[model samples]
Target: MAHPKEVAGFKLGKLLIEGKTKQVFDLPEETGHCILINKDRITAGDGVKAHDMEGKAAISNQTNAKVFEILKAAGIPTAFVKIASPVAFISKKCDMVPIEWVTRRLATGSFLKRNPGVPEGYRFTPPKQETFFKDDANHDPQWSEEQIVSAKFTFNGLVIGQDEVDYMRNVTILVFEILEKAWGLRDCALIDMKIEFGVDADGKILLADVIDSDSWRLWPSGDKRLMVDKQVYRNLSTVTAADLDTVKRNFAWVKDQLDHLRPKVHHKVVIIMGSAADVEHCQKIGKAAKKFGLDVDMRVTSAHKATEETLHIMKQYEDTHGALVFIAVAGRSNGLGPVLSGNTSYPVINCPPPSSNLVQDIWSSLSLPSGLGCATVIYPDSAAVMAAQIIGVQDYIVWARIRFNQLEMAASLRVADKKVRNLSIE
Candidate 1:
């Protein structure tokens, strides 16, 4: 078959494959990587009916790329490499498993069909996962673990192992959690979702396929009473211009919301100092805090010599409000982290300076009294990361920064791997 005319520029060596909304083409530069692009077509009922949905490809491509980048940045494994264009993506090619993994946090459609007695709005406290084979003729039968293991498919020269199945289960839940938390911030209920995975050259399962408006059941205002998803479009018996317009509007709204979505950041940095001489350490702490968008204030006091003064400073931070992260810097049997952690509910992180006696410096932070819940880190950078994580629980801005850090780390590793692979080619 001839390659789609839409795929250009990357020397489309061969037409690798085609899916419902996308087409894969071989990349001339690399043997294992390929480019996938969205097509401007819509289909349902196993392509029994189809329509030319203008601008659908661009919307799906952009939305899917954004979601993939977000998940990848958050340290979720995925098959995405980079967004090549609005309708194109460069990805590491892998044999896709012929199954769709559906994770449900609340019952909606098919579950209502399969389990007729189950209520529609029933919530799964910890979420539920179901796998369906990708055979339209069989109507994608739900497969058990035994069935999957027995089929024994091989991809990229590696057999899918029990460990991989378990890993995908864990990773799928995390993907839902991340997106669920993201949408929750916007006051939307992520009713349920589906994701697919593919094995890379090394047999690592990565989240594959697209996750746009079509992938999840989204209920704005947390009420099933107000449902806006693809099912709304699918349920329409007649495809009138008015009905199609409504569908387009719903998709447009989803795209608009996603485009404007910014992770919220409410960060505060509290710097506790042992003495006036520790101003340098406090500056370092403040610098680190700023990287994660934290507002830092350095207060000089001794945890041991001036316990009352330190407690007073803590009270000031407690009263100021917002998400707080405390950095304790002290020398010689310091108690700032433990004292701060004990007094206030905010997280405390210890970053002690290197002293002539490293053991003493380490103990000052590590040896905490009972009931003290502060964590200790030797490096200032690590302290900032811990603080960012604590703040990320409530703040999306810090979460985004943490997510970016994860992406950069992964990108660096991939770059190193590419370098090693190129050496073999040369």
Candidate 2:
């Protein structure tokens, strides 16, 4: 083994090479590990326009660490190790894939250039996927999936085949979605992005390379005019030191917002039903709540028949510490909601079980006596959503889940609308 060398106070094995904005170092003690040092520089227009912005490298490293950590937590395979320092991090060493996987959720930029007829904001339902060969001298020309599959490229003892290309395609789309959801929590649109994969020593493909400010176009609040990504720095006509500082500040804000999306609340949702018959209704809410990280407890006690038992259920839960919201599941002459609402000060919501008497059931829950304070909702999804929204008030994770759900629903609609609106008569 080579004698360990020191770089930026850390003992690294050997200096491999340096890119335009980062340097790679081999790790002496850790086998198959390498350190990546992000530089305090920003570049665009094929490196013709560049700036050594103060505080950019540390901030980029922070952003990459935050994003990669979230991806790893979501079960996505990556080559990321923890941040080694403010400007560097350790990662599994892998042979690089010679292509970039780009996913676009909207029609803009080069997407418009390639497909001239499409308008801006033209949405891609599942998002449009493209591959670009990593040949900077040849301008990194876009390649089709067929060309990618046909090319026999080997990296780290792994051969690129149709199956390999397909797997990368699927994984790349998944990466885009994971980051898209993360950004959606901050009310930002991840319009499009590019990612590169690498084959590790064990012949497994991992999402490798540094995804920092330069990797994507982000439209905060879904407005291009409010864009706060590397594109902002790229589009500057005449660069000034202040312009670099301004762009650095935008990057700082993104990293700061990412810090707050992680919620640490022990909020619980209690689902109480009037009878065994309403068990299905309560479970519907429970299952849906589970998807959004809500802890649900189901209790069967008739507010009309076994009033004492219902009160006991409430008492049992009230003693537990944390934010609690009660959902009353009952139908026809509904008394469960009001009983729970009057007994406990926790937020009470009424979600009536379905039956032929649905109208009467809705009316019963909706027309609660003047001071009862129980809210009424019609569908199981709505009931679950209402509970989530109430919980989201204090839990950033819950709020993020809600926002991501909303973005998905809206994105689905855009896909369906595009299909109907763009169909050509053949």
lDDT of 1 by residue, 57-140 (tens): 787777787778667656576788877777888888878887788899988788999989899889998988888888978778
lDDT tens digits, residue span 252-300, model 2: 9888877855555678899988888888778889999887778899988
Best by lDDT: 2
- Write down the lDDT of every candidate, Cα atoms only: 0.77, 0.84
lDDT of 1 at 299: 80
> lDDT, candidate 1, residue 125?
81
- Residue 199, candidate 1: C-alpha displacement in angstroms: 1.3
Residue ranges of candidate 2 with Cα displaced over 4 Å: 1-4, 263-426
